[model samples]
Target: MDARYARNIPALTEEEWGVLRQKRVLVVGCGGLGGHLIDQLTRIGIGAIRAVDGDVFEPSNLNRQLLSKVSLLGISKAKTAAEHIHLVNPDIEAQCVEAFMTKDNVQALLADCDAVLDGLDNPESRKLLAAACASSNIPYIYGAISGWVAQAAISMPGDHLMELLYPEETVLGDKSVLSFTPALCAALQTSLCVKLLVGRPVNTGTIYYFDLLNQEFEIIPFNNR
Candidate 1:
């Protein structure tokens, strides 16, 4: 047993740990949710990670972004993710792409990944990612945050959850998340990723919603055309 993952035992069977060490996942965005997602994914021992982000850290990101800090304000999120991943878990294969996922590069960026964890805030970008995952038969773990609220969902290929959830006119803005929102949401998203990778039964095509201040948790079910 690798002493590094000894703490994961009892919770994760030896077989499951071995399984996780052989799989790869792509984490899109490296800001609030992406920061936590990358941290959790690396600590959990996912064999390989491909982190994609184009934005550099700024003063506005300090409040909620885990990899953000005073001395690293001008550093790009991709560079920070690479640095953090190597420092946290050097054995795991890590690749950081210093660009946003766009229509032209989305497919290539997503290639060879077993699963994808969403940390992007824009609906259009999420739509692009969800579409690529659907086409490639990769499991997509959807995560988002707004103020005290966040939502997670699993969109298996052919589910078309993104299309059904976001209309063509969906505009991206007003994403007001607290300091803890991304951490909480990323935990849920990580759990879903583990469940899927470990062959556990998971609810697909459903949004797991959370309202922290109001203490409300709801399951919003939807269907594809």
Candidate 2:
């Protein structure tokens, strides 16, 4: 166990520790957002972690993905993230899946998780994850970025935040994306998941945007319900 996390989490009461013990969080896509989310959650003392990412490390990932390193290239993202978490906090039960999540693996991957964190790169994958979470009645913290802009939504089961937030197919298409955007979105998604685990509600059921070029952060609530 790292001294920092042990000191930061403090000594929990039996009940408090019990709450953390039962939490199983599944983080999909160990890219930029997933890397940072796993890093933070493991440090915060989450009981168990299931990290999934089909992608291997590449040179392009160095800028934002936390787990990417020159020496780590060609390694599995999930494995790298899991190893890092263990080094940071041995108490957390971290598992890594080297394959991408699909219809076949969605249920199995998400089966025991109390919450699902989406760090997916494209809408197709995001759609699949969202559908799985919705059908399972699990909450999905979704985030995406395109260039200088980022968008995030906290989709509870049955809410379908993406559909509500972006009804236009053109807007939801692949053309809208930026490098820095996903990093920002992932940060928000991770924050929301942590809040949920800590027994808090994030009232902003909307898409949050961060314009790095303009240096503006805006929360746009979708009252479509």
Candidate 3:
């Protein structure tokens, strides 16, 4: 074990750390949640990461996107995330795909990954990404934030959690997402991903909801309808 990860200690056994270091994860958005997810995954020693996002950093992103800054305004989010990952852990192989994810490209993008992380803001993209993950039989770590509320879930192969959570034609207009919202959701999503990487038994069908305003946490199980 490298002295860098020595502090991980008994919490992450040598075998578990080795597993994590060999896993490949794909993060499908490079904004708020995507930035934090990539940062945490790199530091935790994920062997390979592919970050995909066609959007560029804007002034509005500074409020919640960790990888966005005044200096990086108008820069590609995927490229920025890849650069940050290298700075955090050069040993990890980081790839940046600067393209909007569509049905034609999603399968190819997710083909080699063991798992996918959802950092998308809109329901349409989320649904499409989830479908891709489902078809590929890759685990998907879903996280979303609206204002002070954040929710996370793990959708294994064949799970319809995404469909249940994001019903079709129910478009939610851009809602205010505070800085802390993505931070909190991303942390939870990272923990779930790590657990999956280490072969831990995660609550796959349950959605963890956090209402920061009310300081309440709830776990709700979703039935496959």
Over the stretch 103-175, how does candidate 2's per-residue lDDT look in tens digits? 9999999987899988787777877888898898888988877667777778887777766655557354444
Candidate 3 worst ten-residue window by lDDT: 165-174
TM-score, model 2 to reference: 0.86
Q: What is the C-alpha lDDT of each candidate?
A: 0.92, 0.80, 0.91
Taking the tens digit of each residue's C-alpha lDDT, what string does model 3 give over 1-225? Answer: 778788776888889999998899999999989999998898888889999999999999999999999999999999999999999889899999999999899999996798999989888888899888988899999999989999999988788788888777677765999999999999999999999989998999789999999999999998765
**Model 2 spans with C-alpha error above 4 angstroms:** 1-3, 6-18, 166-168, 171-183
Q: How does model 3 score by TM-score? A: 0.97
What is residue 118's positional error in candidate 2, in angstroms? 0.8
Which is superior by TM-score, 2 or 3?
3
In lDDT terms, how accurate is model 2?
A: 0.80
Count of clashing pairs, candidate 2: 6
Tell me the RMSD of model 2 versus the true structure.
3.1
Candidate 3 scores a C-alpha RMSD against the true structure in Å of 1.1
RMSD of 1: 1.2
